[model samples]
Each structure stands twice: as C-alpha cells, then as structure tokens.
Target: MSNALELLKTRASPKAADLVPPGPNEAQLNEILTIAARVPDHGKMVPWRFIVHPHETRAPLVEKLIANFRAGKPNANDAEAEKQRLRFTNSPLIVTVVSKTSPNPKVPDIEQLLSAGAASMNLLNAAHALGFGANWLTGWAAFDKSSKELFGLADNEQIVGFIHIGTAKGEVFQRPRPDLSQIVSKR
Candidate 1:
C-alpha cells in the first residue's frame, strides 16, 4: 500500500510507556508542526496556539501535576503520581494545543474550536506519518482553570489536548473500531 494509505490504515496511538526516545528531530518537528497548522480555519481566524513543552519542563510539570492532583484528591496514591510522571516524561516532546476562541462576528467560537481540534488531529497524523508515535491526551490538568499560568495559557484560552510525540518502543496493535453501519445514518 501507499505510504499515505498505510498511515491512514495503521495509525494507532501507542501508550506513553511504549513511546520512547528518538522522536522527530528539529527538521522533522518543524515539518510536523507546519502540517499541524494546515487545518481548516474558518474566516482566516487562526484561533489556536501550540505550546511546545521541552523535555526539561517535563519534571516541573509533573511536580505541579502531582501537587494539583493531591490537592484535589487527598486520597490519591503513589501509583497515580507515578502515572502522571510517566505521562509527562515518557515522550520526548509535548505540544499542548490551546483553543483561543476569539470574539469574531463572522466566525463563531464553535468553528474556531473545531479548527483547534482539527489541528490536534493533524498533529497526531503528521507525527504518525513521520514515523513517530503520537498520542492526544487530556486530563484534569487540562481543565484546571487555576493552573492556566502553569501551562502559559490566557484567560480566553482552553487546552484542546496535550499531544505527546516520541518513538514507539516496540509496535502498536490495532484495536476495535466502530462499524460504519452503527455510526452512519441515511438522510
């Protein structure tokens, strides 16, 4: 099969644990980001922003995530902390897609939000096409309004997802997909 067709067919997000080092280098990363931005933006309103978190920031982010998690759930345990630590650190790069839906008379914020979601999907697709394992994840850290400063997000901006990019430790297996009959309906 053609590369494009193969990617469309075989693309599945590997677990963060399965995602290891040797991710896209500088040039590849630039290419991936470039493609990620090539999504549908209604009325030329680029309502999304990408926050590329460097590897060094992972530890600090994890620390804050742990603190916040503990604050919210005092009953949380070490396993949960370790899980967050791995989620932030297992990947070589983390790109947080922020949806800054601006007030546009012509372009609704809903459309802009969709554009941001498309951009996130494009990021995942581009990374997979470039031979990298990518995962689009969102958790409590994404919705914690108090932690906007930690993520460098503005009051008007909300996180769409945290895109994790890295090399696959082994390989990804295909999971069950919904059938078209179950999802589609005739007009």
Candidate 2:
C-alpha cells in the first residue's frame, strides 16, 4: 500500500493524558501548521484561525478557566473540575481552531464553518503523520462565552476544536470503526 494510504489507515486519536512531553520543535510545529492550512476552502474564504498555547501560557490560562468554571457552577463535582483541568494541562501544546465567517454575497456561514472543520482535521492528520500524539477536543469551555473570551475569541466566533499535541507515552488504542457497508451507499 502507498505511504499516504497507510498513514490514513493508522490515523487515530489517543487520549490526551497518554501524550507526553518532547512535543514538536519549533520547526516541526511550523511545518505542521503550514500543512494544516492547506484544505478545501470553498470560495477561497479562509474562515479559520489557530491559537497556539505554549507551556508557559497554558498554565495560567487554564487556571483562570478552571476558576471561572468552578465559580459559575456551585454543584460541579471534583470529577468535572479535574476533567477540565486535564483537558488543558495534559498536552504540552494546545492549538485552538477558531471558526469565523465573514459577510460574503455568495458564500454562507455553513460552508465557512465546514472549512474550519477541514482545517482542524488537517491539523490532526499533520500532527499524527509527524509522529506526535494528537487529539481534537471540545467541551463546555468551547461554548462558554466567558471561556472563549479567555482565548480572545469574539462572541461571533466559535471554536471548532482544541488540538492537543505531544509525544506518545503509552499504548495507543484502536477503537472500533464504523461499518462502511452500512454507512456508504453507491448512488
């Protein structure tokens, strides 16, 4: 099989906690981001942006997020808070994909949003191909306006995903795949 086909076949998202340090160096990250930007963008409307959080920035940023999350929800249990903490802190690098739509006479918001999703998928593939452990994640924080504010995302903009990138530390599980026979139909 071709290398490209093999790469696609093996692509899978490992747990963020299973991802360790020694993430992509500066050059590797640059290459990954460059490749991620190459996607099928309809109408040439590049309606997505990436927000990178390095180790230093990610620490405090997550703290603020945790604080805000806990403050708003008095009934939030320890598990909930811990889960949120791990989501942001486990990976050494976090890249957030922000979806935004510009007013265009021909293009609608859905197409633009789809382009953003493409960008996110590209990011995951690029990271995996580069031999890094990566996963695309989104939760309450992504939808919260206040949390979005922490990332400097305007209310009009929505988050497509938060990509965690790092070196693999443990086993990478292969979950079950959907049955193509049932999902795919020839026209």
By TM-score, the best candidate is 2
- The whole-model C-alpha lDDT of candidate 1 against the native structure comes to 0.87
Give the TM-scores of the predictions, in the order they appear: 0.93, 0.95
In model 2, the worst 10-residue window by lDDT is: 147-156
For candidate 1, which ten residues in a row score worst on lDDT? Answer: 144-153
The per-model lDDT (C-alpha) reads 0.87, 0.89
Model 2, which residues run further than 4 Å from truth?
none
lDDT of 1 by residue, 58-153 (tens): 777778877877777788898987787777887888999999988889999899999999999999999998889998999888898655667878
lDDT of 2 by residue, 1-187 (tens): 5998999889989898878898899999999899889997878878999999986678888899998789778699999998889888989899999998988878888889998999999998999899998999998888877888888987568999999999878778989999999899998
lDDT score of residue 75 within candidate 2: 90
Total colliding residue pairs, candidate 2? 0
